[model samples]
Structures are given as C-alpha cells and as structure tokens.
Target: MMPHQPSQWICAGRFPPPYDGQSLLTQELLELLSPEFSFIRADATARPPEGRIYAPGRLRLRRIPEMFRYIHHLRWLTTRYPLPILYAIFSGNPLGHIRDCVTFAWAIPRRRPVVVWTHNALLSLHASPLWHRTLHWLTRRATLFVFAGRSLYEPLRDILPEEQIAIIPNLVRRALLCSQTEVERKLAHADVSSRLRLLFVGHMLPEKGGWQLLEAAFLLRRHGVPFQLTYVGGWVTSHDASAFTRRIAELGLSRQIVHHGSIRDPETLRQLYLSHHLFLLPTKHPTEAQPTSILEALNAGCAVIGTPHATLPEIIQPGVNGFLVLQHPREIAEAIAHYWHNPNLWYSHARAARQLFVERFHPDRIRQQWIELLRRVQQSIPELAQVTT
Candidate 1:
C-alpha cells in the first residue's frame, strides 16, 4: 500500500524509534499485516504509552507539556482517517491510555469497529469495581478485544462476551532469534567452570528486583561460589545507580560485578543475551504482563529465574525451562546453585527454553494469529470487509 492511501485498517498505537516492546511489536504488525489490509498508522509517539524511563529529574518535567500537545493533535488526526476497523494498542496505564480513550469516546456515536489490544494483563484483572465498570462500558463499544494470554483475559470472560475476546501472544523478530543449535551451544555449561556468568537486564528500580539480584550476587560471593554477575541497562534514576554502587561496595561485590550502563548496540545486546548462562529477573512488579525480554532470553536459550508475577507463571514452567521464586536473595542463590552443581540440568533447561520459544512466541505463528484475528473482525463486522469506491 502506498503512503497517503485511504486504507480500511487504521492502526492507532505506539510506534518505534524508541525501541520499547509495545512500539516494536506495533511496528512489526504494521509491516506484517499490510498485505492483508492497506494501512495507516495512528502513532502515539509524543511520550508513548511505554518506555521513556521517567526519571525523577528535569527530563521527566520537560515531557509534561509535550505529552498533552501530542494527545491533542492525535485526537484531531484520528478524524482524518476512515477507521472502519481500528486496532489500538494499550498497556493499561489510565494516564497513558487517555488519548485512546478520547478517540474511542469521540467515535462512540459513529460506532465504528474498534479492536483494543491490551499488553498489561493485570490492569483490567486487578481494577477496582468502578474501574471494572468503566472498562465494561468502554469494551462493550468495541467489536473485538485482544490480549496476550488466557490468564490475562479469563477474568473478563463474564464482562466481555467470550466471542468478542482473542488471545494472541507477542511475537519476536526472526532476525534477533539465534539458531536453536547456536543457542544450545552458547548456553551449554562446561563440565566445570570457575565462574558462572549471571545476568540481570532491566531498569535499576527496586520494584524490578534490582536490589534483590545484587544481594543474591553478594550472597553467592559470600558462599565462595565462583560467579560473575553482569548488570546491564541504564539506571532509571541517578539515585538508583548510586544506591546500587553503594550496595555493591557494602557487600564487597565491586570486582565480581560488571555494570554495563545502557548498551545501545543491537549486536552487543544480542551477545549479552546469548552469552549469559542464566537470565535473572526475579521482579515483583505487579503490573507486569509477560515481558518481551523473557521471550528474548528464551530465544537465546538462557535458563531463566523469574518471580511468578502476573502472566509470568503462564510463560515460565518452574523446573522445566526456568525457576520461579520469590524475590529473596537466599532462594535465588539456591536456584542458581542447583544449575551450577548440575550442569546437565542447565543444558536440559537451556534446550527446553528454546523449544518453548519456538512452540509459542515465534513470529510465524503470531502472524497467523493476527491474520485470523483480522479475518474474524472483518467477517463478524461485515462493514469492515467492504472496500471503498
């Protein structure tokens, strides 16, 4: 489809230059779903619904005015397109979802076919009675609703008609995926190693289990375990960095830890995921849906150790591909030790992780799911399938 073409499908969601998961996924679908439906993007980039680490600093303050400006323009922009079938990506922040809400509200009178794709599972799952009521009212306006998993949308089965909901997991780009053989080899543990390469790749926020991961590293060192913990990604705040540094020093873990602040290169990031033996993200963040990083790590065939929060339990089968534990340093240390002492166990889990990724998260399967969804929406709402003269 050429640019400026008045397409039947209007995809109004976050789009990337920022490289956040939601935007990247949105961008992928826009590309993949194009042949089936001529497309125009209604991007909410002016402070997207996800990413852009809102640090407790001047930069965050600077984003306030610009955010409103973008939303206002987006409201005006939506009117330009004939949205016979609208697909809007939402990650469940009431504030971030404001523009989409406005767009939905404005189109209520016209009653166009709208499909809301929700990323964060717990938002609707854990809402107050008032919030649930609000969502029911809004969702009833749409022809279809899409979520990542059954566990995510199961609770809404009563509120949303079963036929109206579809569960489609997120997809990983094929290029980023390492071959299964390469992944297994890279994740293979030597019969014996002096040091185990452990990794934690996310924000430095306490809720993200950064403190717990560092403390686990300290405990492992205290036990005289030969392991090196590599901490990657930028600290969300200078204070987070400072406190992390102070904790490492206090625990005498300075030399054993390598803090790679904000790795921008795709190759380097891929190398980190592929090289690391264990990907540790024992996050307790309640709002987390299934994290794209977990899929990425599994794609690289790294054994995972994650807290069973939100949709993580559905993704991680404890003792199969990964260990699900509470955010306790001692428990985390023990899980790592199990893999360390049992190298065979590590290799088995590594293979399992890759298989899990292929069976569930691969783009080929995800693309098929999206195509079915598009067809379902079109067939169910015949007006959407009609071509403009």
Candidate 2:
C-alpha cells in the first residue's frame, strides 16, 4: 500500500516585510503547517515603491500595480494545481475585497473550497452600509471563515452559517517562550525593591497608544512610582517620530521612558520580554484584533495591561493574567499603580500569564486546531476526501 500524499494548498496572504500581527500570523501558518501539507506561496505583501516604506492600510495610487501582481500570481498558481484549496486572508475594506472577489472568481465558478481568514473586525463597524452589504455578498463565496477570536465572529455572524465559522486564536513563535531556568532566574532577580520594568512592543503610532502610554508614565512619575518603561518599535514616519520626541520631552518622561526603536531579532526580542515585568498596550486602533505582542508578553510571564477592545477582553482576565483598562490615560495609570503597590500581586499575575499562554496559545494546541480545521475542509471536497481517507 502506498502512503497518502500531503494535500496541496494555494496559501495566499501577507508575508513579512513590515511585520505586523496579520503578516506574522500568516507566516506562522505557512511554516508550522508545512509537514502535513504542501503550499504554493502567493505573496500578497504590498511591496512599497523604491525608497518608500510599505504601509498596506494607506490609500495610495501606487498600490494598484502591487495588487495586479498579486492577482496575476494567484491566477497562475490556481491553474497549476488540481482543485487546490484557496486559503487566503479576507480583506476588511471594499477595495481589497473587490480585488479578492475578482482574483478568486475562478474558484467560485468551479465550486472550489476557499478558507477565508478574518483578522480584523473593522469592516462591519467602519464601512458604509453599501460596502457592508457588498462585503456580505462577497464573503458568502468562501466555504469557511476562520476568526482569531470568538468575539470577532460578530461581524459576519448574521451573514455566515455557524458551521462555516471557526474560531482559532493566533499563536506566537515558540522561540519567544522562555525556558524554565530563565523564568526562575527572572523572578528571582526581580525583587520588590528593584524598579519595575514595563515594555511595549508595537508601532509607535498614536492610535497604538504610544502617546497614551507616555501620558500614563507621566502620571506614574507624578505619583513617585519606581519604574522603567521601554518602547520597542519605530515611529510610523519621521514626522511622527519628531512629534513623539517633543511630547516625551514636554511630559518630562525622557528620563523615565526610552524608545529602543524596532527590534527584529527574535532572540533579542525574547530577552527583552523575559526582563520585563509588565507589557503595556493601551491601543485604541480601530482595526485591532488579537495582537501577537500580548501573546509574546504572556509567554514571557509578563502581566499584560491593555484596553477591552476587540478580542482583548477574552484574552485578558482581570486580577488574574492582566488588567483591562479603559482607553483613557487615567485608567491606564491606575492599572499600572495597582501593580506598583503590590509587587507580590504582580508576580502572581505573571505566573498566571505564563500558565495561560501554555494552556491557550501553545504551539501544539494551535497546530491541532489547524489540522482539524483543514481535515474538515478537505472532507468537504470529494476528491480530496478520498485521498485523505
């Protein structure tokens, strides 16, 4: 008897250049699932023009060529494979959705199964009613829709069947997980007398709460809290960077806070996470979903402090792994002060955070979910079902 061959999938989505949560998660799926499956890469990464930064969300005329390149590749890849499962990220905006609708139009006619990954929840809230109805019509073309969290299903709940929707939380890289020895050493050296180290890892944009975090730091300083806040990301632009610097100086948080720019090296980032006692992301970004930074912090045994936005409330348990605060500076400061007064409480929360990561976002757990979801998808197709069985 011959062994069964791995199923071929045309996995199309954003791969890293800019390295945001969605792009990283897409990369994670491709790398981690390669053993059981084969993939034909259709890179949807919107490469920026020469000497320009790649920003996918911004509306620019230059992106038209990039979109055409992706569409052309996707069409060619689909033709090469025999009934390949079309796994791609479902865009949240009308322009992107229209592009997707056109690119995957071939699959729709042939009744090929497409797995749509939903990483953002902004389309339902921010899009116009006409676009919403259009998105609803376009979304039905997919055989299945995967969501990052349970709360994220609300946007397409009314339009999609219950069986078509599957909840799968995003997983962070395993390298980010600290060793038992490292965790022990970190906790041992972290004495109540020492300064509490707080870390924030994301773009230094106002919407991402960089400014709000600085304001909270000022409030903490006024209350005489002993802490060091490190910002581990680059500003969106030189102008934003300049504005941030001016604001930091004006708030007199230059001494208490520091920006380390963007650290891409995994080992260095892992080390930073291990050294910090708290991870702060008071983001009010409209398109926020399940952020990988929160999971990274959880893996390193650092208690998270974030707003109850998107799928955050599900990820954070108040007084357990972390605290969910309002998007206001005062509330963020209060959450920080909660840990300042009780170092032991912070330690307990840190342990709980690590435990939550182990139980919830472990690589094995995430892999199993993907395998099951893929198996179900394969079972739906007659030819693929025969090959699997």
Candidate 3:
C-alpha cells in the first residue's frame, strides 16, 4: 500500500456487528485501509423505506437535503488530506440498492473519485422498473464498480466498462482477530473419525439448504456414522423455523441436530467455528455472493462442505480444502462419510484451508488491493492526482 499517497477516501456502507457477509466486508476494508488512506466512515443506514419516500420515516427523497453535510464532509477531507474519494457500497436489497444508487448519482459529479462497491450479483436479481433504471443510472455515473468476486462481475460485462470493475473477494477478519496458533492447536489433534462436529452457519431459509443437511444427517445416522450438525443463524420465516422444528421431531433426530439460533458476537462465533471439524453451507441460493461463512470456516481451520455455487467453486477445490458437492442429500452424506472414514483427511484439508486464507484473503493482501484500486480510481480523474501532488 502507498502509505505516503495523499488519498482520503470515504467508505460508505453497513459495517460489522450485524454479523453478516456484506457488513463484515465493509468493516474489513474500513480497518485495513485506515493506516494508509485518510478514510471517512459515511455510515448511511440503508434501512428499508420506513413507510414511503419522504413519509413519516421514509428515505426522505434520496436524502438529497443531506448534500450540504456530504459537501461539508468532502471539504473537510480535502483540507485534511490530498485526494478525496467516496467508496459508496451497495448490496442486492431493492430498497438499499435504490438508496445507494441515488446517493452515488448525486455525489458522482461533485465527488472527484466515487466508487460503487457491490457485494453481490446485480444484473441477475429482479427489481422494479424504477429501481432498475436508477441502478443503471448510477452504474453510468460511478467512476468504478468494485465487485466481491469476478463471477459477480460476469453478468455486468456488457453494461459496465471492464476497466471500471475490480474484484477484491470477501476477505476474512475474525480469523485474523483470533489467535492462529490456538485455533490450529485444536485442529492439529482433532479426531474427525469419532463423532464429527459439523456446522451450518447461514440463514435458516430453505434456499440455504437447512433441510438438505437434515436429510444428510439421517443418512449418516443410518450408516452408523456418529456426527452432529449444528444449524446457526436465525430463520427467515417463522413458519420455516417451526416446520424445521417439527421435521426434526418427526424424524426423531432432534438430539443429533442442534440449532444455536443466531450467533452475533464475533468471539462467540469464532469459538463455535473453532470447535467444529467441518463447516457445511449447502446453499443453492442464487443471490449468494462470496459467502463470508466459508471464509470464516477456513480461517478457523475447519474443513468445508458447500454446494457448487458463486464463490464456492473458486475456493472449495474438490479434495483440497473442502468438497463442493451437488445440492443433494446423497452428495452431502457421502462427503460427511468420507471425512468420518479418513480422519487424517481432515488434518490435511484443515491445513490447506488455513493456508488458502492466509495466502488469498489475508488483511495484508486485501490492503494492497484496496490501495491499488483507490489509486486507479484517483488516476482516472486527472484533477485528483494534480490536487494531491
């Protein structure tokens, strides 16, 4: 990273504590870029339209009135540093997407180097005509669009300039925060043959493959493979959670299947990841960007078993770090059984997973990428370099 490059950037997005992928990425960039770049945190709460636009608690007509505040902040950044840019972040949510789009649209002309950092696939998702047009408008105006992964940028090939897009991947943070030696100490002597400790850390939506894990559990039980699958995170629908509870009862496998509800605390979540031998995310959720859970699993030195989708294929190399199985019970069952049969396999994979995290998603690598991208964006606008120099 260019520590001496007089660049002041603003990272505007949802930061951590909500304990999700998007928020975690925002937080990672915010902290990683702090030392080198003069960064301002524009914590625009992209809450859903409270009632209606400008109504009792709506988005207040694009928050356009707040332009004075943004301009003031920009002036302050320029005075304090050299090159001032806005790294506005966005996601797949329709309401938040529109809000960010509008905010960037207004800020683009005024702000020297503005980047729209997207954490998910945009072109693939469905949106209303109005929101769709607004997004396209923002895309045109944005100095650059940063995607979480290259696969995410594939669909936007035609619409967005190739030069304007970059992928830094959803890097891991909690893994680095924890004591690496302590985390690997448990894995080094873990007995994967005896009752396997499996983890599923994602929303309890059907698309997340919560039921498929249950089916795999049944098969593993029938095969006499001792294993425990714990489902973490909250349910999307109350009906689904209730139905899942009943399904566990009907199958008489409540004892084997554990649900920790939603784990928000990072330390607690880190410990949970450390205790488990395998992390399972059998999700076919189409909107799945680079999942932060898989990265967390790797960082915690846990082998992964996720379905082939999104960033899973990129990271979960078959028989390497984790198994990217087809979205089915049989595939998942076979994978669980494989690890149970060969305990040594877990050690090798655990090593590989941690190595992958350190090499690809480490903070040092992420920091350099952010610095380069920021520099690239600043260079695109001739005035930014002149002003900073």
- Candidate closest to the true structure, highest TM-score: 2
Q: Between candidates 1 and 2, which one is better according to lDDT? A: 2
- Per-prediction TM-score: 0.88, 0.93, 0.82
23 Cα displacement, candidate 1 (Å): 2.3
Computed on alpha carbons, the lDDT of every model, listed in order, comes to 0.71, 0.78, 0.72
lDDT of 2 by residue, 1-389 (tens): 22445776777788877656677778877788878876777877875433234343567787788878887887776665554554656676556666766776743334667788777674443357767666666667778888889877775567777888898888888667677678768777886445778899987767788788888888888888888899987655778878888988999888888888877678999999998999999887777778889988888889999998888898899999889998788899899888879888888998899888889988779989988898888987788677544
Candidate 3 per-residue C-alpha lDDT over 173-206 given as tens digits, one digit per residue, 9 for 90 to 100: 7444546796668776687877899999876777
Q: lDDT for model 1, please.
A: 0.71
Model 1 alpha-carbon miss at residue 381, Å? 2.3
After the best TM-score superposition of candidate 2, give how far the Cα of residue 85 lies from its true spot, in angstroms.
3.3
C-alpha displacement of 364 in model 1, angstroms? 0.9
Worst 10 residues of 2 by lDDT: 47-56
RMSD of each: 3.4, 2.9, 5.5
Of the two candidates 2 and 3, the one with more favorable TM-score, higher being better, is 2
Error of 3 at 242 (Å): 2.4
Cα error of candidate 2 at position 206, Å: 1.8
Global local distance difference test of model 2: 0.78
